[model samples]
Target: MKIYFKTFIAIIFGVSLLGCDPAEKQNKNEEFPILGRKQFVERTVNGETVVDTIDHTIPDFRLVNQDSIWVTPKSFENKVYVADFFFTSCPTICPTMKKEMLRVYNAYKNNNSVAIISHTIDPKHDTVALLKDFAQRLDVEAPKWNFVTGNKEEIYELGQKGYMVTAMEDENEEGGYIHSGAFILVDKEKHVRGVYDGTNSNDVDRLIKDIDRLLATYNEPKTKS
Candidate 1:
C-alpha cells in the first residue's frame, strides 16, 4: 500500500507540472538579450554605495511620418516597434527588404501595441508626399507603419547611433545613399531586442518569432496555482 501511494503521489506531481500554462513555458524557454550600454548606478549594498550596469535604451527623435505628422519617441511610448532605413528610389535591396517588412506588417497590422517605422535615408527625394504614395502603393497605413523622412543628417545619426545600423551617402552605390538592410526590433522600454537581415526570409521569420517572444514579456502569464 505504501509503495502504491508513493507512486500515485509522484504521478500526480508530474501531471500537475505538465498542466502548467504553455505560454508560461514558452516564456521560460525563450530569452532575448537586451542589447545596449549598461550604466552603473549608486546603490546601497552591504551598507556601501555600489554601482551596477543597467540596460541601455534607444533615445528620442523628432521626425515626420508618412502623414507629415511630427513623430517623437513619445509616440511609441509603451509600444513594441520594428525600425528600418530605406529610400523610395533604391533599385536594389530596398524592394526585397520592404517585401520582408510586409510580412511583419501583415502579422501585426491590427495589433495596436505593435508598429513599424521605416525611415528614409534619402530624405531629399523621399518627401512626405512621396513617402505617403510609396506607403499607399505598398498597402501600409500610417501611425501603424510610418514611412518617415526628416533632416538627412539626423536620420543618418539615428541609423548609426540610435539603432546601430549603417546609413551614409555613397555615390558609387546604385542608390545615392547607403544604409543597412537590417530590421531592428525594439521593446516597449525602447531597448533594442533583436536585429535581423530584412532581405532574408528566414531571418525575417526569426524576427517575427522574436516579436512574439518580446510581446510575451509584456503579457501576464497564467499563474501556476
Candidate 2:
C-alpha cells in the first residue's frame, strides 16, 4: 500500500520544471516490476560483477546523519542496506513511511549487517536536532539506522537524478513537495538489487528476503574505512 496525498499538483509542476519525460515517470499508481529474490550480477569498475543485482548502480553521494556526522557512499562499503526519503514535519505519507521503517528497524535490530538510511526532503527544516528527536519518537536505535540531512540541491539531485527516484517541490501548485516512499536495496558490490515500498509491508518483507539472498550470494564489496 502506498501513502496518499493532499495534493499532487505542485509535485507535477516540479516534475515539469525538471522536464520529466512522461514515458519514464512511474505510472499514476503502479509499482515498478521487481523480480523476487534473484542473484543477478552487477558490473563494476573493479572488473568484477557483484553477483545478485537488479535495477541501478551506486553513484558517489555525500550527506549528513541525524547526529550531523558527515556520511558518504563509502560509509556503507561492504554493507547491504535500505534507504528512503521523508521529512520530519510531513503530515501525509511520511508518517506511514516512518512507521513502516520502525517495523523494519525492530525486525532487523539484531542484524548488524543490515542498515537503514532516511533522508529528509526538507533539509532546512529537518535539522540534526529535529531528526534526532523524530527518531527518538519513533524509537529507532543508533548506528544501525541513520537519519540524514544535507544540502537541499544535492538531496534533490541524488533523489531525482542520481537514484532515479522521484522528488520535487512546487509552491505554485498543490503539495509543497513530493517524493516516493520506496526502500531501495543495494547489494554490497554497489548495485541496487531491489526497490521496495517502505509504505507497503509486503514489499518490505520481500525486501528482507532479497537482502538475505544478496548477502548469501555476494561477498561485501571492500572499501577503506
Give the count of colliding residue pairs in each prediction. 0, 4
How high is each candidate's TM-score? Answer: 0.82, 0.70
lDDT of predicted model 2: 0.75
Model 1: how far residue 64 lies from native, Å = 0.5
**lDDT to native, each model:** 0.91, 0.75
Instruction: List model 2 lDDT by residue over 1-225, tens digit each.
Output: 133352476677887867756545643333423323344765666786566555456667888887777778777877877888888777678788877778778877998778888888888888999988988888775667889998898888887755567877756523477888888776666666677888888887887777777676555466534
- Model 2: residues >4 Å from true position, as ranges? 1-56, 172-175, 219-225
Q: Which lDDT tens digits does candidate 1 get at residues 1-225?
A: 999999999999998888777868886786689887777788898899888877878877999998989988888878899999999999989999999999999999888999999999999899999999999999889889999989999999898988999999999888788889999999988999999999999999999999988888788666744
Give per-residue lDDT, candidate 2, residue 216.
Answer: 62
List pairs with backbone clashes in candidate 1.
none
